[model samples]
Target: MQQWQRQKKASPKSQLKVTFLGEAGVDTGALRKEFLTEMLSEIERKLFVCNGDGKGKNPVYCLNSLDQKYFRIAGEIMSVSLAHGGPPPSFLREWCFQYLCSGDADHLQVCTSDVLDMEMSLLIAKVNDATEDSITDLTDEIINCGYTGVVSLEKKDRIVRAIVLHYTMRVLPMLDQLRKGLQLYDLLVLMEKYPDICLPLFVPVHSDDRVNSTFIMENCKTLFSEKGSVRRRQECG
Candidate 1:
């Protein structure tokens, strides 16, 4: 009877929880660096496969025009990195290679279209006349709509979902800042100064609310009350 029970237990499947490298409550900096390194290396390998070895000799005329275009973009990005005296930023590398992967043009286009649609939504919202309360609510509604769209896409398409999520998280906050009366040029400069505004979006699989709330709490000071800011400043001081 004991042997039979053991066999039965062994036969039944068990659930396995797979954790990605940068999940919450873990030290992710080193892991992210490693992931970026591997990603860049993979991209370089694919580029060599598409365009020829990085030698001065002309590559074989083999890749299709689309493939060639991807290679050119990747090459130009690297050139920019070299001119700046370092490797390209992690996000830029990931974004470029994401489309560079063969057999993914449709996915790339879909992701791009989704982002453009979200931008159009923001623009329309900005153009509409509204009071302070309505504008603030509209900003939140638009962001939530975009967030929900990406979350839905995640069920079927992780790559496109990730691309859209990254863009939405990065740009929508800036739009909110603009809605709060920050000048467009100032917002652009702030974006440049703080390029990692959407870094939390890359946190490994978690609930939509958890990810969204964590990002907003960490990145947005406008969400805090004046009293909260005063307390925090007093504490820090």
Candidate 2:
């Protein structure tokens, strides 16, 4: 890790500049497609690990402590974005929200209900099958190994969601801010040092004739519209 950090520090810096386009020049169709593609890819990657057959090592487990922190931060950012009327990232909607909550219910109620019971039961079965142990024994071992406690499934879901929400909220805005021309190397350094902003520090933002500053900014504004006090109170509380 130290060696990698030193190498990163010595790396050359790059910058990503984002600009907005005027209405006359904007192609809403192309922009929408690009946005959907990026979001879908991100969601699919996250869910693949959770739903994959027990075979090769899980990338989620392979992450170092710092990387894990960043991952959770990213999750939290997505959660807050959803709460503020931003579109819920596909992964959060499918994996965390769907399993943890029911339609029109609070997160707490969702966690405590039977929403995830079937999924958890299947997951437990898979674990026991792989480990050659009884379900109860494997569950106990899982708790003892410090992954999570033997609490009710809902409680466990609530805890996981809390961690996810925290990280996601912090990471997304930071990524958005990077469009203001932060050096790629500096961004990498920040992520490395903080270990809580899960974005890749070197994402390239290309601007062609078709996609300009107005388009980018307008899309962002539309997606992340400011929610006033009433919405904030309802969502946050």
Candidate 3:
């Protein structure tokens, strides 16, 4: 992905040509589309973590990935992919997509389900499911997560909201970098103006329909063994 950044000097208006390092192929247009599709698919799986029901995704907060500016790379890749007839991210959470479009979290309707971190989500769940007997034990967990407010059955709602807020707010810096990368080709502008039209580009209605072995089987050509050979018999079996 770092290699793609070298394209900063290249003209965005010109046609993009894609080529593999070792593989040889002429990219009239199909190869470019294939490259963009594969790139976006991999980024969706690797650079982010699944949220509720494992459908929506939130960016993984890694100090190393942040220092390396992976979020920026991801943004730029998505923009290029979209501009060059490639797929959109289509895996981001609704709140995340909203933040990208508006450049702020002020209007985002976030909830405990929005939190992606397993440990944090589990802790928040415990707080929500806490009873009169469990409130004291859950108090320490909440406080350890940086909540200063008093914890009780009555304050569980407030405590949960604070934790979720802090969790979501922590990703703002990373989102800022992603926004920077998305500045390419006025992608962010279109998103801001036509949020409804561009919604599917970031968040899909049927996110569960992901790429799988079926895609490979359908797209890839099957090679047959020579007729009457042992390999052919084995293949038939």
Candidate 4:
């Protein structure tokens, strides 16, 4: 990723090539296509977590991910992949995607449900569903997170929402790094300028973006030797 970052801006605007260490096939765009697709999956697994709904994804708050700038690398990968006709991330939460494009969390409409951590989400649920019996336990959980507010049943909703915002706010640094990487190929500018057009790339609104055999056959050109030549027979063999 660092190597990719050091390249001239014009480099990523061109076709991408991929060569496997011990593989034999020539890269006729197929290898590059597959590489980008796999890289998106890798980024998802390494740096992001899926929401409770199992569709939208939020960035994970791992210090290592931030320190290593994995989000930035993911941004670079997405920019280069899209520039080279590869698939988009398409798994980010709509709010997360919007935050990337706008860099303003103040406008996000986040809720307790957006919290994906099992324990955290459970705490949120308990707080949201707090009753006379559950208020005490829920209050202790909120306090553990450094919230020193009066946790009454009437204020549970506010407390939970504040926790959610605090959780999301912790990843601001990670998002800043990602924004830096998205600067490649002027992608951030394009996304900000044409959000509707670029929305499908970051959100899973279009299932067609997933590359398939038909897409490969349509995008990849096959080469063949003369029909009567030994090379043609060798190709068949």
Candidate 5:
């Protein structure tokens, strides 16, 4: 175990900016297919991939290649650096951010959403996933990052409305938790919505149990500090 840890440095993959996009020889389950479909269509995906290995480090585990592929299907994957020294000879690299291979700036936009953010044109792609276009993923990247204003800006339209009904079903009930209130009271009220988005956190795999949802603060009322996390004092001398 120690040997593996020493060797397994968590930097970018040394090879071809290679993203393992869902391997398959045709045997993938329905749930995985559904997830894949959603993932492929999702516009906000960053590169924080969940491997099928199913260790305790992620919110969801890719049980099969299908799950992994489903995640990549939503957005196009690009290779940021072609050679070890730098990018390609062209002004644009083969791939830029948004996980896309195309470097064209004027292509028609597509509506993409994760299982979580389907309705809103808004997305919170991970910091690691931040390329030229930054996606504000709902993970720690949202609260801790120095961004307090709107992260996503798209006028609502057809593309943003595909899963409107489904998103409504999950969002309406869960929004009450975002209202200002005591944390414990909020937890008590929210605990009733178990297994839903309103629940603290729910993931298909057991590994997600450690990903604490309570830390997703909807506001930045406290002042900033250098030492990480703020002190909420009414007045200080």
Candidate 6:
């Protein structure tokens, strides 16, 4: 029985949790450094990391892209994330090849050239008034400037369900509109539909509300009121 148990322990059905080194508690600089450290830690498990600037650009963690055969050669997978900021920094790109993916031939990376902060709903919204030229320009902006990406995000939310009522009078696009409702929440929910994108780059922001919101994302202000922001929030709820 003992031997059987030991064998079972070594079975392929084992899972492990790893800290990808993001902001320890809300300190932006510390978060970057922490994540950098995790990137340097043990290289035995599969890693998925999200890279974003404190807010505007994608923060990135890559092994290598220079030598395209990294995945073919490296044993461990290193998934790079860019789900938040517009474009991840170039240094991260350079370093992916120079360090993570090169000398340590044990790692590989996954990359997609998309701004970390795109929403399907928002994209749909842009279709009405935006031209094809505008869309292409937007994509280019996202890739080139980095966080400087020209994301064509206009009225990101819509009350489609409410509009489809029997007695509900259909309203024209520009003619009828709700005042500032769930602008950021809708955007985030839309972004979250892409799990592949959010995994590696899940950075927690600070807020006084019980629920998190982009409107009050104070990455640096974890504890604003003496009442203890997060704690007080929980207590009140």
Per-candidate total of colliding backbone pairs? 0, 18, 0, 0, 16, 16
- What TM-score does each of the candidates earn? 0.19, 0.27, 0.81, 0.79, 0.16, 0.17
Kindly report which residue stretches of model 1 are placed more than 4 angstroms away from their true locations once superposed: 1-28, 49-62, 65-69, 72-237
Cα lDDT tens digits, model 2, 2-64, are 322343443223121112355344544445344434443563365223333222111132234
Using lDDT as the measure, which candidate wins?
Answer: 3
Residues 27-81, candidate 5: write the lDDT tens digits. 3344434433333223122313323333211112223422334222211111112
The TM-score measured for candidate 4 stands at 0.79
The CA lDDT of each predicted structure is 0.35, 0.33, 0.80, 0.77, 0.28, 0.28
Please provide, for model 3 over 1-237, each residue's C-alpha lDDT reduced to its tens digit, 9 standing for 90 to 100.
677667768865468898978988899889898888888888777788885584578888787878988888899888887777676678888889899999877888888888999888988888888898888897777887678887888888889988898888888888888998898887787678767667776875775655332342344445779999999999889
Task: After superposing candidate 2 on the true structure, give the runs of residues whose Cα lies further than 4 Å from its correct spot.
Answer: 1-29, 32-36, 47-62, 65-88, 93-95, 98-123, 126-237
lDDT: which is higher, 3 or 6? 3
Preferred candidate (lDDT higher): 4 or 6: 4
Q: Which TM-score value belongs to model 1?
A: 0.19
Tens-digit lDDT track for model 1 on 1-237? 122234444321222122355575442344434433443455444432221222111112223523334433333333222222233323222222222222133444333333434444353434244444444444454454453432222232432354455554443322232222222113223333343553222212223543232343367565333665887777656
Among all windows of ten consecutive residues in candidate 3, which has the lowest summed lDDT?
A: 211-220
Assess candidate 4 and give its lDDT.
0.77
Which residue pairs of candidate 3 clash?
none
Native-structure RMSD, model 6 = 19.9
lDDT of 4 at 14: 69
Q: Distance (Å) between predicted and true CA of 27, model 3?
A: 0.9
- Residue 223, candidate 4: how far off, in angstroms? 40
Top-TM-score structure, candidate number: 3
Better of 2 and 3 by lDDT: 3
For model 5, the local distance difference test gives: 0.28
Local lDDT at 123 for model 2: 47
